[model samples]
Target: MVGQLRTHGELRTDTVTRAFATVPREAFAPGAPLEQVYNRDDVVITKRDENGLAVSSVSAPRIQAIMLEQADIRPGMRVLEIGSGGYNAALIAELVGPEGEVTTVDIDPFVVDRATQYLAEAGYPQVRVLLVDAEGGVPEHAPFDRIIVTAGAWDIPPAWTEQLAEDGVLVVPLRLRGLTRSIALVRERGHLVSCGYELCGFVPIQGAGANAERLVLLQSEDIALRVDGDQIVDADGLRNALTLPRVARQSGVEVGGFEPFDDLDLFLATALDAFGLLVAKPAAIEAGLVERSTRMGAKTALEGGSFAYRASQATSEDRTSFEFVVYGHGPDADRIANEYVELIREWDRLHRHGPGARIEVFPTATPHAEIPDGRLIEKRHTRVLISWPHLTSS
Candidate 1:
């Protein structure tokens, strides 16, 4: 697993590589097969709810490695880890060495009990495993050099900012507009600014800080929109639109067949005034009701009684390239489809090669004048700013 991580460039430093090499992952998951334990890409789920949804898990090795790389944990630095699993705490203990403090907290009592037990058995008894909701942070160990959240967070709570040391960094998987990015944020003046971000996902946070995306169903449970904030979802209007003919438009933008367009997804999430992710079940796609993109949550723009979603068509006979297409439905289909297509072209022209959005979080009381120029998303605890930079040479 260590070799695979290093080969893929996920393990960028010797200390982290050594941590992965030394930690006995099987000690945390006793009955799991060795093959599953050692799989670098797989996550080991530890507990689940009554509905069978995973509530606690040991994250995939690759993900842990990459996030640790972003964290840049140094020896003798205090670290606070939220959403504890025994294995991750062990890996952190290795990075912090014997002198440094590693405190891991979780809301689930079962997770805490086992983590405490496993830490002792694994020779990491010094790692503190606490049964507490991390929404307020561990006050006894304030001013941590680094804070890493292992759950998906919808908003930045003021406590996280207050507990972090002035020069400290916080790495969290933050959900924005239904998209989750592992953002590494640092204190800049009175706000937290993202130094870098990478696409990643985690189980929704549980307890006082939990806020999840709302799914508005268009066709029973099969077709729906993953909505964030106050995006409108006219279910009856959209159900009627899906039955009517779909209005389609082609954008001149093209991407290599093997290229990743996650950046384009981020662009649309910010550039559009109203956006949600269109989700679909296999039955809907098999009936030719929606494009395949909906299976992976397609980028969608919504207006009253109307909506448009992004799709793609192969441009080459061998499928070596693809051109973006937008499909709309309902009363204002043409206008919504045109607006969606124009944004696609705009992203290609200005942001395909330039820096992506610069995201920042500030106190909710921050004056509008103080907030940077960009989309201002109002959250309960903070105001988020997403500003895109200008074009750069390819």
Candidate 2:
């Protein structure tokens, strides 16, 4: 597993690679299958709620390695980890070594108990395991040099910033627009700027920081729209529109099989006026209610009741290349789809080969004039700004 992580460029530093090599991932989950513990990219679900939804999990090894690399932890630096599972805490313990302190916190007692027992059993007894809501960070152990949040967070709580050391790094899997990106941010004056971000997903954080994404069901339990923040969704009107005739448009954009287009998703999420993720079950796709691409949340644009979602068309018999396509629904289908397609083309023309978006988080008290020109989104704790800067050709 460590070898695979190194090959994939996730285990960048020698210290991180050694941590991966040293930690016993199987010891944390006693009864889980060996294949599961050794899986390179799959997460092990540790706890679930009454509704059968995963509430806590040991994140995938790939994500753990990526976040650890982003963190750049060194010996003798105190680190705080939010949303605990025994394995990740053990990994941090390995990186921090005997000289440093590692504290992992969670809101649920059951999860905390499991993590505590497992960490002890895994030979990481020195790591502190606390059952506390991380909304108010562990103030008792302040001035952490590195803070890594494993759960998907809606916003950057003020306590996190308050407790972060002057030169600390806070790596969180933050939810922006409707997409989740594990952002590595550092303090900059009155704001925080991202050094880098990686595509990732995690079980949502619980307790005071819990802000679950709203799902608007359009086709019973099969199809729904996943929205975050204050994006107003008309469930009744959208449901009616979903049954209307489909309008499809093809953008003159082609992509190779292994090419990464997740950046385009971020561009649309920030550039579009109103955006949400259109998700559907496999049955819905097989029944022709939506395309196969939508099975894993598709980027969607909304105009009142009308909506449009992104899709793709295979351009090669070997299915090694594909063209971007858009599908629309409702009275404003044509306009929504045309607008969506234009943005697709614009991304392909400009940012497909350029640096990705610059994301920053600032306190709500920060004046709008001080913030950079971009899509400014207001949250309870902080305001997020996303800007795409143009590059100067040499």
Candidate 3:
């Protein structure tokens, strides 16, 4: 079954494909609605509480595959699955086989109970389900071959690193700026080195290891963007733009098969440059609202206005399109859109499609710091790290 399933999915091997098929997703999702249990789509929200918010869920199959591949798991491996819900642990167990050991942990005791019962009922009782704060990890089962975080973490906690075995791999969804990226970190010579990056979104990692949410306030309009920092610069121009009257708004636009995905860092850097003027000055930050359009486009609303503009173009078009229902002349439309257009073209100058692309996260604390002469990297307030060369390299 796994072999056959592999032919249809993005996975490379029949082994993983089989594991997915054999693991009846329904068993682990006991309380989940039928549609979600059988749906092979994206993540299925399973546990939402009184406040009407999602607290836990079964990750999408595609995401599961991506993480598993990034983990580069091997048979007979000792693995640790954080924020366990039984479904992912069950999949890992199937891949690891009887010879391998899988320790699954969750902060909620009830979640652990459910995972244990589900795994036992499924006849894979060998999988250990522990009720503990996974943020600190299950140190008793230290030195895991691979540690997979099912939730999102704003920063890599030191404890997880300390528990990692030499050469171990840790797959986590790291939140950078406001975007989440799936990161694979390998323990190399006592250091956690980046193995790879993938575009992703996941629930925030809870517990003592959680990071404080960064909040951004848009002065005039109701749009507030929360990243992990207060160092938002150049928002003045945007703030001033907010004083304009609203005339029109477009829903959104679409962009696909673009080079940005190939190199997210370059895409972000270009975005920062193109939008830097707005991000740098106080006027811009207070002026408007910015929201993600399709993977390649963005929707922005002028200040004191409710109208929106969708920026996108045909897949084959040489020049991208900025589609908008202008409000009251949208006097600044051409200048703003042209600024974005120029930034997108700069992708070629930096070669944003591959390797040289890098995304750097800055901590919310101090605005500036000194780097040691011989060190290439400097840790930032446990939540961020900035490379020495990056400051002057640009």
Candidate 4:
């Protein structure tokens, strides 16, 4: 894997390249499927139920490369890995070398045991594997030079920020409402700064750091009104539009022969920016109908009559703009589409470009605490409300 990474110019120097080539990936996988053991693509299927929902897996090679580069691992650097996957720990160990230390922790005991064995078999027993909740992070090893979370975290836990060594780098799949991004945060002068790295996907982190899944099942009699920032329509207007027919359902548009889920999320984010609202539902879950997943992005149900809505938007893999196929017996779909178009026009009027805006995240436990007074931003799915006064122009 490291050899291939070097071929792509991922390894900057011969010393790093040699270390990667010497580390055999097969040693870590141990009797895994042949296709997965050697396949350079993202093929590690860590968790699969009888129904085949992939709960966890090692991320792809390119993603690992991107993260490693962002991590900036150096010799004699102490590294702590959240969600103990042996492959990632081994890579970190290899990068940090013998003088440095690598400790990996996982929430699942079985995963930790397996990873420990795998590391021993691969001659990397030096990498410590622990069975503990990683969201809280392994504070016992305080002041780590670098910390990486293999699983996604809904927020930058104060524990993580507090434990982070000054001038340390923390990399994790950060969940923002409906989507998750591989965030690279560096602690400088007690401030965690984001590099706005590429938007990527990862399974949501479970346990303490996991967020509430916002897709609510509606009751039979209720209704939801959907709106985005690109349009000015409010919840009431959406209720009126629910009387119309669906406008575009499952219309497939491919970009470079690949479904553009990012593009769709961007579109949705745009709507959230102008309208400041998203799908809304009645209090009851049984009233709504299950909406099917799109070929590219979100799958929503029109259960009951309403879904949540957001007033402002930020583009993310989870919050991109895409047309949804609503399943309620109302005009909600038409209403949302019309409002979306209006929001787009307003964006043009205000000279808000369809692309490029940095999303800054600050996580807090209380709803009232840390509320930005200048400009409001909303994460539609989680009903998370925030504001970035500084990001208004972009």
Best by TM-score: 2
Q: How much lDDT does each candidate structure score?
A: 0.90, 0.91, 0.59, 0.56
lDDT of 1: 0.90
How should the candidates be ordered by lDDT, best one leading? 2, 1, 3, 4
| Candidate 3 displacement at residue 303 in angstroms | 15
Q: For candidate 1, write residues 236-346 as lDDT tens digits.
A: 887888887889999989998556788889889898888898899999999999999999999999887789999999999998899999999988999999999999999
The model with the greatest lDDT is 2
* Tens digit per residue, CA lDDT, model 4, 1-394: 6656666655556545555566666666666776666555655767765678765677666567667777888999999988766877888888899899999988777678878988898889899999887657778888798988887666666677777788888887765434556777775333455654546666656677765443221222343333322333334443543444435432222123233334334334534533221232333223332222221233232222333221222234565444322232244555544454454444334423333334444444335454434223433222233222221453
Give candidate 4's whole-model lDDT: 0.56
User: Which residue runs of candidate 1 sit more than 4 Å off their true CA positions?
Assistant: 316-320
Per-residue lDDT of 1-394 in model 2, one digit per residue for the tens? Answer: 8888888888889998898898889887778898888888978898888999999888899999999999999889899999998898898988888999999999989889999998888788999999999999999999899999999999999999999999999999999987899999998877799999999999998889889888888989899999987788888889989889999999989999578899999999999888899999989999999998888899999989999999999999999999999999998999999999999998887788887888999999998888978888888899999888764466
Q: After superposition, how far is residue 384 of candidate 4 from its true place, in Å?
A: 8.5
Error of 2 at 160 (Å): 0.4
Instruction: Point out the worst 10-residue segment of candidate 4 by lDDT.
Output: 294-303
Give the winner by lDDT: 2 or 4.
2
Model 3 residue 127 lDDT score: 95
Clashes by residue pair, model 1:
none
Any residue pairs clashing in model 2, and if so which? none
